[model samples]
Target: MGYLKNIAIAVLALSLFTFVVLFGQLPALRKTPLGTLQRALCLHLPNGLRSVDSRVTGGNITSKSRRLGQYLFYEQNPVVLILFLFLLTGSAALFLWNALHRLPMSLIVPLPIVLIPPYWFTYLCATDTDHYITPANHQDRLRDYPYDHVLFRPGAICKTCNLVKPARSKHCSLCGHCVAKCDHHCPWVNNCLGRGNYSFFLALLLTLGVLQLYGAYLSYWILKPYLVTDATRSLPWREYLPELGDAMVEAVNMGGLSIAGVGLLAASTAALPLGLFAYHCYLIWAGMTTNETQKWADWRDDIADGGVFKTSREALLSHSRPRSPEGANGAASTGLAVHLGVTEEEPQVRWPISSAQVIVRTNDGRPPRGQETLWTQIWSLSDVDNLYDLGGWDNLMEVLNGR
Candidate 1:
């Protein structure tokens, strides 16, 4: 009973912590209680801790502690990756060792085989070095995608890299380099998922999810006979809470506790990767990256607040030209342009689809009023074209091909 209680407490606590860490900062949940709790945990709690530490150590400990926290959480480190691998390997090893003699040949053959792909793909993604954009290849990288003028615009340069920022590229502070078509940096893989490694990352997620579900199923299979043999003593299924306690006890008596625990862990954690994979699939279908989706969500909020306005893409493109005579530059040349009184540049890369509208934001809530035909008020995102979207099938191909 004590062991069961301890395990349950530990699992619940870990699940809660993971939930807060994962979904706390999501834009969709920003206004919800979960978001507020996340802010409190991430921001307010840290500040409070720092304040207490400052008082305790006369300000000696605050900065160091903050740096440690940043390095552990925000920066690239192998701690989480090591922990993930340890958990995966440890659980699988323990389960297989315990069940080796009892398990059938068919189950034994495929169990280890299922793990191979995720490990291989994870290694490939972690070691793949093709995503980084350097000064030597920055010119060629610019041709990968065109700026949509909403989330990404031409003429912007990365100050750190001192190169023209390509559409969908972002400078990863941890990597200290710009990655093309940057997805979020994943600490679990200890790698940045970008244009080069995104397919492998997806494959890793899918395979890992399968591995976890398989682990859970095997665990259940091993425990089922034991559970059935003790049916007279087993509590009713309708009373799940009490029945769970009885089940745990039966598992321990049958020498299946470790396997049962692994199943619980697998079942609990499997949802995370499967959910993430589904969300990424949605992003691929929508022709967006995680970064771009966040930007679009922000734009949607701004539009709702009446801070966003739009103009015809053709009207803006007419005044802008390629930045260089060589036609290699996508940035707009220095010249007065009508939209927002800022010079706009034509996209260097010829995108598959063209933007129907150019969207801009004003600091004040007032809409931009001018040539009514050119500058029209956009009420929603549907009013503008998603230049990245070439339909779901093509977008999936683009991600898979790493273009």
Candidate 2:
């Protein structure tokens, strides 16, 4: 009973921690009560602790503590990856070992089949070198994606890499390099999911989700008979609540609790990856990346405040544009000035994919001046075009084909 209780407590605690850590900062949940609770717990609690430590140690201890925390979780460390591998392999091994006699060969055979793809993909994504955009290949990298003039505009430069930022490319601080079509850096794989490896990352999420759910089901199946048999005689319908509790206690005492606890843990943990996979699928359908979604949301907010205005893309491209200071090695000018709604006098480079509309921002909330093209007011996000969106099929194809 003591060991069972400890296992249950540990599983629940780990599940809660995993949930908060993974979904706490999600944009969709940011305004919800759960998000608020997460922020308070993850952000405010640590900040409050830092304040207390500052007063006690004159701020010396706070920075070190914060740095250590960042190094452990945020930086490209293998600690979380190792822990994830251990949890996955250990749990599967334990469950298979315990249930070997009871389970048929058919059930056991599929387990490894389902697990191998994600494991292989995770390794491939983690070690794949093609994702990294080096200064030497910066020119070729620029040709990958064109600035949509909405979420991504031309003329932006990666200060760290000192290269012209390609459309959809972003500098990953932890990786110390700009990644093309960059998604968020995943510490779980100890790698950045980008243009090169995003498909593998998605595949990893999908396969892992299936694996976790399958694990939970197998665990439940193994324990169900014991639980049912124990409950049948001891649990009475009249005192439903009390009898149910008694039945659970009896089952635990009879050694069914560990199996039940593991099932619950797997089910809870599976929710995270499944939810993330669903969200990413939606992003794919919408022809947006996770990074672009946040940018679009911000643009939506700016539109509501009347800070967003749009002009015809043809008008902007018709004029000559000078190369930005950052453009040295035949790189496009980093000063395209989407905010200005016009280009400076120089030769203009055509993007592979052209945006239908040129969207710009204003601080004073007034539309750009001196434009022959009609400056339409964007009241909502749907009014804008997602240049990246080739239909859903093509969008999915892009991911699968790693384009």
Candidate 3:
């Protein structure tokens, strides 16, 4: 039943993909006003079908052109296409075979398959905001009917969400909740990186960016027009315009130019991922996340007090703060509170920082000028009669105790 369910889901996914790609979105490429006239005069072929002349709807040359192009390409391109299909099908089969045979599915297989597809599509169909394009003009209403007044702002943050929000907060529509310092929910990671997993998420994105750029380089070269005849190349854009008129000619020319321009456009698009990767790297070195970066930019003056490091140290120590609140022993809360917060932000001490720095700040701030005895502080802090001091690492226990 499990195997059957997987097969059913896979088939449904593939069928839906085919329907959407073949008949839904891609076919509209041929119905453009420019494409319509091109097909009328049989000037160029539509993308999927091959010939524009043959598929003419109104007994026009456009139909004939589409048909002719489709036929010519189909017959000639069969060998190349069949080889691609065979490889793709074979790979799928091999994957299924391993799965069915109870082979130890390594983490490697699903990682790339899951991560790359969404990322590739994200890059491929990216719009101005590095988000997926809304099909048709679905979101055009938001743009066309601009709200200039104060009432326009959709303040989605509720009271509960407001208090929990630290800095760089955003509401995830899919998750239907406000996340603290949210970056993006990544399916490949299989974990929503709010505050806990953010650093690792940044690292993953950096690694993916490198992998994708390398792949795009290889795919770009392979798609370069190697077998094009000069007849195809020599036909100037101007010459085609005279025969097909401005619109049809432009369509025909674009159809051809698109074949060549893909690599150049891809190279240009490469800059986005590269630039993002570099920006994040800079943030990591500066001990910041996307959230922190935004906050730093928004309130640069607040950092003047040198509170950032102090606050980070406080948050780091918050977890292990001594909880002996006026016990029977009444030991003068000899426990020193590390004032890590530099600025006035209340929860700034709860923010994330490196573990090493956390320990250092909690143990001793600016180790005493000469008597820099780390063990002295450790022994003092760990020396409660009823308490167990599981603090030292390995044989360092004797060394710390002796101090």
**Regions of model 2 farther than 4 Å from truth:** 1-21, 135-137, 230-244, 253-258, 316-353, 369-374
Error of 1 at 91 (Å): 2.3
Tens digits of per-residue lDDT for model 2, 305-334: 997877665444443233523223212212
lDDT of all predictions = 0.77, 0.73, 0.35
Task: Identify the leading candidate in terms of lDDT.
Answer: 1
RMSD of 2: 5.8
lDDT of the structure predicted as candidate 1:
0.77
Q: Please identify which of the two predictions, 2 or 3, would achieve the higher TM-score against the true structure.
A: 2
Question: What tens digits encode model 3's per-residue C-alpha lDDT throughout 32-100?
Answer: 654454454342323433444346544476566657755444332233334433543453344334332
**What's the CA RMSD for each of the models?**
5.1, 5.8, 23.6
Local accuracy of candidate 1 as per-residue lDDT tens digits, 284-380? 9999898888888889888888877786655554434454333222233113243333344464575676665668787776544333344566798
Error of 2 at 41 (Å): 2.5
Cα miss at 28, model 2 (Å)?
3.4
Between the candidate structures 2 and 3, which one is better when assessed by lDDT?
A: 2
User: What TM-score fits each model?
Assistant: 0.85, 0.82, 0.29
